[model samples]
Target: MVSYGLEEKTALMTSLTDKLASTENSLIESTGRLDRIKEAFHRSEARYHSLEEMERNLEGYQEGVKSILLSKGGDTSPLAGIHGIVADFLDIITPAPNIPNRDNIEGELQAEKVIEAVLGERLQNIVVEGQEDTKKAIEFLKSNCAGRTTFIPKRPRPEKYRIEGKALQQLSNISGVIGPAMTFIEFREGYEALAEYFFSDVVIVDKLETALNLLKETNSSYTFVTIDGEVVESSGRITGGISNGKSPGLIQKRRELRALKNELLRLEREVSGTEGEVERAKNEKVLLQVQIENINKQIHEETIRIVNIDKDIEALIDDEKRIQLRIETLCLEERGIDSEISNLSSELNIYNEEIQRLLAEQAEGEQEIQGLIESQKLGRERWEEAQRGITTRKLELATRKEKRESLSVRLKELGERIESATTLTTDKEESLSKIDQKIDGYLREKSGIESTITDLWQKKDAISKEIVAKENERAGREERQRLSEEELKEKRRVMEDIKKEINQFEIQKAEIRLETGHLKETIYTTYQINLEEEIKNLNLKDLNIDELTSSLTALKERLNRMGPVNLASIEEYQELNQRYEFLTSQESDLTQACETLHKTISKINMTTREMFLNTFNIINEKFQYLFQLFFQGGESKLVLTDENNVLDSGIEIFAQPPGKKVSQLALLSGGEKALTAISLIFATFLARPTPFCVLDEIDAPLDEVNTERFINSVKDMTGFSQFIIITHNKRTMEA
Candidate 1:
């Protein structure tokens, strides 16, 4: 009962174990499902994050593009003027410049400087009247303007300067050259005219000493400048100092943007290389797979051979067992036959002994008959019966002998059959043993091959994993490439947007500047006022019309209430205005006459000054060459004494005589003065070409050397003007 109870308990435990096992299986399945769900959740979260990030990035990109065009709350960009499609392409192709102060700057040197920077000096030069170098710059800019400065400004005529051949690159003493004044302002294309007009003559030098030297060397021909922003006038005077130049940040930003484009090109090249490597890896993996297929084919053939060998070994074993069973059965039969023959032989031997005992009993019965005549008959009868039994025993012995002989023959046959069966079994067993050995060898070889195949499979699996990893890496790289492409596209889109905005800003800036200039010109022309200064601090506010009307009505009512107060004052004012008009008319008539006289004088003065200027220019040109001839080697120039007032300006001669410090004309010797006077008279005559000239002892105090110079000077002017010389010196007369 205890054992039975123990068995029952064991059965119950087994049933519980089975149920627990089933529950474990269910739990494992549920866990796998949960793991898959978790993985899916993670993937969804990552995707959502990526999407959100992309959205933010896109918004930022758009804002950045917009900001590139916005400055001072206005869009003075080239993109504004350009058509939409072309502007987008323009962004991809060119480096756009940033204009500063689009809203507040116009008709100033700063504005022109910005224009020059955007459109380049060559284009600005073309847009403004300038020297030969300027024209050359214009041509150069035109030749190279395909991808740069898409917008151009209306032409402006600024003051002309003779910046010629040797002057083009002759910023020798320049400390650092700032661009044309157009480079400084952010106003649009039209504003370039103002900058060009203002900053045309600015040239920066290294130091004050350099500026002074430049001023001295060229007679301050250009507006010389110091690096610290000190300006030198053409008359060797300095003005403006201490950093008057604007920042070059806009130009710097343009260069940086160009650099970024170059970086984009470089990264694109790298991406191309990565793509090629990925393609190569794919090709290599394909080759590896081909090799794996070939190996698999060989392994499959070997596996089939091993299976066939196993089947052959099993069949041989079955045949050997059948042969062994046959041999054992034959051996048992042979032993049974031998046992039957032996039993027959033993029975035959017993028959022979019985027969002999019967013969002895017959002899004993004959002896007893002889010994007792009276009982002879009973003895003979017993003896005869014994002889009869002996005869039967003899017959039985003969039959038994015959049966033994036959049995021996049968045993011999059985023995021979057993020997044959044993031999056959032995052969079969040997064959079976050989087959087992062969099977064992094949099995061992198969095991080794199988082990090698298992190793190959393991290696293949590892290689597959590596390939999977490589594929994943390639996929990752491809994804990154795709992302990079998307980013590049985004950048391109932003750049296009920026370009369009910049173009628009440029157009707007031009319009705004034009309008501002027109407004100023109109205001000044109509009101004779500096409108810009007046409006600089002015702001307009909206008025409530209803409130203003109510106030006006109240004032009218107050005036009505104070009626009859100004009637007499009005009458008196009207009477006084009539008298005043009569006096004013008389004054006006006198003022008109004075104005007419002043105008006549001014017109006459203007004509005289104009004629003087024309003649002076011709004379000045001749004088320079003439002075060089007279002095041998030095420069001389004619300057205005009162330059600020051209009509009343007096001529001041500046001559650097050869081997002499020509500080003042009064310091010259008498002979030198005479020479200088002759040169000037000759130059003047050459300019206007007077028909007649008379000299009264002009060379009265001349030595031989002076006389020779005098004769030459007279001869030079002999072409157009007749000269009469009353010289005591024979040398002067002869020459």
Candidate 2:
């Protein structure tokens, strides 16, 4: 019965052990699933946060649109008139409730690139309530000096392009034609005009080939956009290609954000369910463990009971052996008594009483022996039964031992699994800790970089202000120099006029001297008299000859008829000539100073241009090299908008990645732009190495291959420049 009980208990324990193992496995699996779900949820949550930040910052919107949206307060606010961006108002069309698959058209329509290609920059066009609102918004944008933005008034305007009636029907009948692009979008009431303005004359097709065929067959002016974002314009120009991992458009970002949010919710629910399952399994495991322990205890008690039975059987066997020995001694003594009775027959009369007593004792002895034999037989039977019981117990014990060993082995396996799980958990925790440390370090570095950038911006502003002030000073000096030059020219002209007057006076004086000399010679020859002595001798009171007096009077009258003449005219002419000479020297000095100033300015400008061009050439060379290195095969160059006016001209970058046409930097896709910018930056660094360079997610848009190139480039520059890179990419972290 005990063996049976032990068997039952063993079976129960084995079942419990199995249950525990299964529960343990279930718990482990559930825990692992929960962890996975949690990881997914965290990733989704992070994505949602990033998208939310982008939306909040109005990252991809035009500057004017963002300005208007952000300008929600104050008297000059255009927020009242603003109706948000076109992308915000429009939604991708979903299938009807009854249609199950709907040919998977909804997914194709939801491709942001398709809509983006169809609308182009129009997606960022600010929608307004009316023309008045647009005007107000424009005025606000202008007042704020915000960048330009296109506005679409919600009020209907005259349709510029439309496919109607037969044309529309014919186009719709074409194979692979989805419909007008407008049909793939949904918008609120009163936004139809805005939608039609962008979507009119635009058709969506499944393939570029279909769009091309439609365009060729119709021979009409229409814009066709393939679902893959290829655009065939009315002018027969085709623009299509895969972009270099550019960030999704705002519409796509919104859609992705929504999807991530849904995914996060689903994961959260799944995590909760998994946790609950784990909890249930844990509870079952605990219950099974308790039952298993209780079964073990019962099995232990049964084993102890079997052992005690074995001890009692051993004691009974020992007692039977002793009793058999005593029986043997009594039988020998009875035989001796029989021999003595035959020899002492003569003495039988005398010992009659003694014989009767001996018989009585013998009878008692025989009865006792019979009782002993019966007891021995009972003991033997009992021993035999104990032996059978012991055999059965031994088998049961062996079975129990086997069960215990199996349970022990299973428990040991569970322990090993638990230890492995613990080790894994420790590793995961260590990894998490390391990641956290890295994050903290990155955050600190980011903060430092931001602070540095802020300081640099402040310094830039200060430098710009100083430059403006210097420019203003230069302009003021130029104006003063111009006025001084004009004054010097006037002074030079006056000096020239004085010189001409002096020359005329000298000529007149010479002519008058010659005439006077001729008169004196004629007087001396005709009258043989000295004119000077006569003039000294003659006076008004003592007049000499009447004819001479008359001539003198006529000469005096002629001189009086002319302008007044001073006897100090020679002295005055000498003084005026001295002043003219001084003025002439001053004019020469002023002219020389003006020439020197011009030369200085020319030298400065030449030096500035030489320095700028030198730096530009070096950077451009490095840029070309780095561009090729980054892109594997590409050409890029830096161009001055006006090389003649290099100092004031804008720099334009023309980049042609491998197998691509040369395009302006702005026209490149996001990843391409990032790579291009990195090339430019590294080129500059090579040209003028700085102490340190700070890059904030510069590799975010780059793919793995390009990121590797970028890291390598950075490593190459590590000899001279220290790099502070802030990124979340695992590859970047590893590097």
Q: Pick the candidate with the highest TM-score.
A: 2
Cα lDDT tens digits for candidate 1, 277-355: 5445545545545554654675677678778877877887777778678767866876776677577668757756765
Q: In angstroms, how far off is 74's CA in candidate 1?
A: 34
TM per candidate comes to 0.34, 0.44
Worst 10 residues of 2 by lDDT: 96-105
- How well does model 2 score by local distance difference test? 0.71
Error of 1 at 147 (Å): 24
Tell me the spans in candidate 1 whose CA falls farther than 4 Å from its real position. Answer: 1-277, 293-409, 457-735
Give the top-scoring candidate (lDDT): 2
Candidate 1 has its poorest 10 consecutive residues by lDDT at 84-93
